[model samples]
Target: MKDNFSGHSDSYSKFRPGYRSELISYLVSLTKRQQCAWDCGTGNGQLAVKLAAYFDEVYATDLSENQLRNATPKNNIQYRTEQAEKTSFDASQFDLITVAQAIHWFDFDAFYAEVRRTLREDGVLAIVGYALLQVDESTDKVIQKLYSDIVGPYWDPERKYIEDLYKTIPFPFHEEKTPVFHDEYQWTLEQLMGYLETWSAVKHYMRDRGENPITLISETLKQSWEGFDTKTVTFPIMLRVGRL
Candidate 1:
């Protein structure tokens, strides 16, 4: 897996949106047991903290120690710095395995091998993520230009999986149908900028140019965002659940 967010782990933990309760409840309902869960590539423990409430134990692992350091603490949750493709977990340990917004970075074959080895017979593997955020048409137009024109070439190849909505990703399991879900937030323009700053492509652009690209679109975004102290931002959730 790639370690893209470690440098701005603090910003990640603060600005990234959490999974909605409806989505969490739905995942919990699919499990036959709530004994334990493994959240792989669990950046900042966002999904791990949620699983903690439903399971006896939740083990969240990430390749970035900086991200793990800022993870939210829960009594039943254990955060570790580990790769997604391999782990020290025992066989048939987890009742459910979850990868939230991080599976695109994994070596799928290797990760699936570990999933098959560690997941119980009835365990479900849930891969979840969200599409690009949507706001008003005017703001969205400016944002789209920034995404496609400004930093388009900077995005990693793995981003194609997300753009395809995970439909084309390798999944060798019995797939389950899932309901449509979304994450909605009331955020200010500054909050939106903070979230955009967390994008890996933006980080890559800054690295190569020695300048933050967000500055280029700031004034336009401010003008587009005028008249609203807080705007409704919606992220359409994409989920793929399966069993080995």
Candidate 2:
């Protein structure tokens, strides 16, 4: 299971997008108290670090030691090496629990049970994700071909949960309306390539084929990316916020 990110922790830390402040503000408004938050599957402490600014204490846990090692520390955030389904936290200790971009990899039955065990009744649970990124129609075509035709077969089956926007997942909670937000970035071709290098499917394709598959799309991507100073890209950030 940990092998999914076997050696890509560095790329993940450097390249993965961060959550927008609007999402954080919306979560803060929903919580009755901003006492504590538990960020499960907190790979590289991305969201956890941000949560630390709002919550008094932030508990960030992950199964991957290397990912934890790569995490940048904050005074209020505590990092732990642990699985999503099993934790040593006290019962009803968290006012908020967040799972960002990593929920598809969790054992849902075990994780939801743990969430109920750990979260306060008034606590908010936010399952955060983002859809495919878009720069422009032309750039999107190159990316789509690389993602669908080239690396699609290499993606783990669980990725469908993200593709479907978590619609089929069992989320038993009193749902709350959330604000609309998008995670945007102005990145050069190299930065975009760096981000693509962090994809699990790309990693799988490299390991199995003994060659970097992203290289195949370099020429095609240049067609759209070369002349632009820095392409503007955006992802529609999705949040399923609720309470038990």
Candidate 3:
């Protein structure tokens, strides 16, 4: 898959939001066995660390060594540098497999082939992500401009999958109906800025334009953020679950 976050691995581990417990609980509930799990494109081991608590073993893989290096260590979680489409995993190895916020970067057909090869017959494959963050209407307006007007062209074509909430992505399995979930956090303007900087589109813009794009909207964000030092930023979680 793509290795966009490796350069800013530390910032990604620090600024990226964690998955809600409810989401994790639901994934666990779907699994018939908690024997093992594979978290592909597991940047910073965010989801793997949580899976470690439920599974006997958690294998987390990513293309970037820098990202793997920054991953949180756990006794049951084994971090590896590997691609999403190919791996050394044995057939019928994992009870559950997950790709959080990174499936858009994968070769879907190849990855699905690997999933079918390695995943147990009853195993669940969960694809998870979050939509654009929503603050108040005023703050959202400035952020949307930055997202659409400033760095819109910089975003990769794969981003449309997230925009459509994964509905448009190819899913060739027995899909399960999932409940809607959200990640809510009380974040300062600085935190929001840091999160924005983690966007792959922002990185692309910086590389092409030779300047940070967030600067274009800093003052406007501050002006719109005036009444509150901290505000609840909600990200509607996008999830698609299925079985082999």
* lDDT at residue 121 of model 1 (Cα atoms): 97
Model 1 per-residue lDDT tens digits across residues 94-145? 9999999999999999999999999999999999999899998999998998
lDDT of 3 by residue, 42-130 (tens): 99999999898899999999999999999999999999999999999999999999999999999999999999999999999999999
Per-model clash counts, in order, read 0, 0, 0
Residue 157 displacement (Å), model 2 = 0.8
Per-model lDDT: 0.95, 0.89, 0.95
Q: List candidate 1 segments past 4 Å from native.
A: none
- Each model's TM-score? 0.99, 0.97, 0.99
CA RMSD of each candidate after superposition: 0.5, 1.0, 0.7
Q: Encode model 2's per-residue lDDT on 24-134: one tens digit a residue.
A: 888888899999999988889989988999999999998888999999899999999888888999999999999988888888898999999999988889999887898
Q: Report the backbone clash tally of model 2.
A: 0
The deviation in Å at residue 2 for candidate 1 is: 1.2
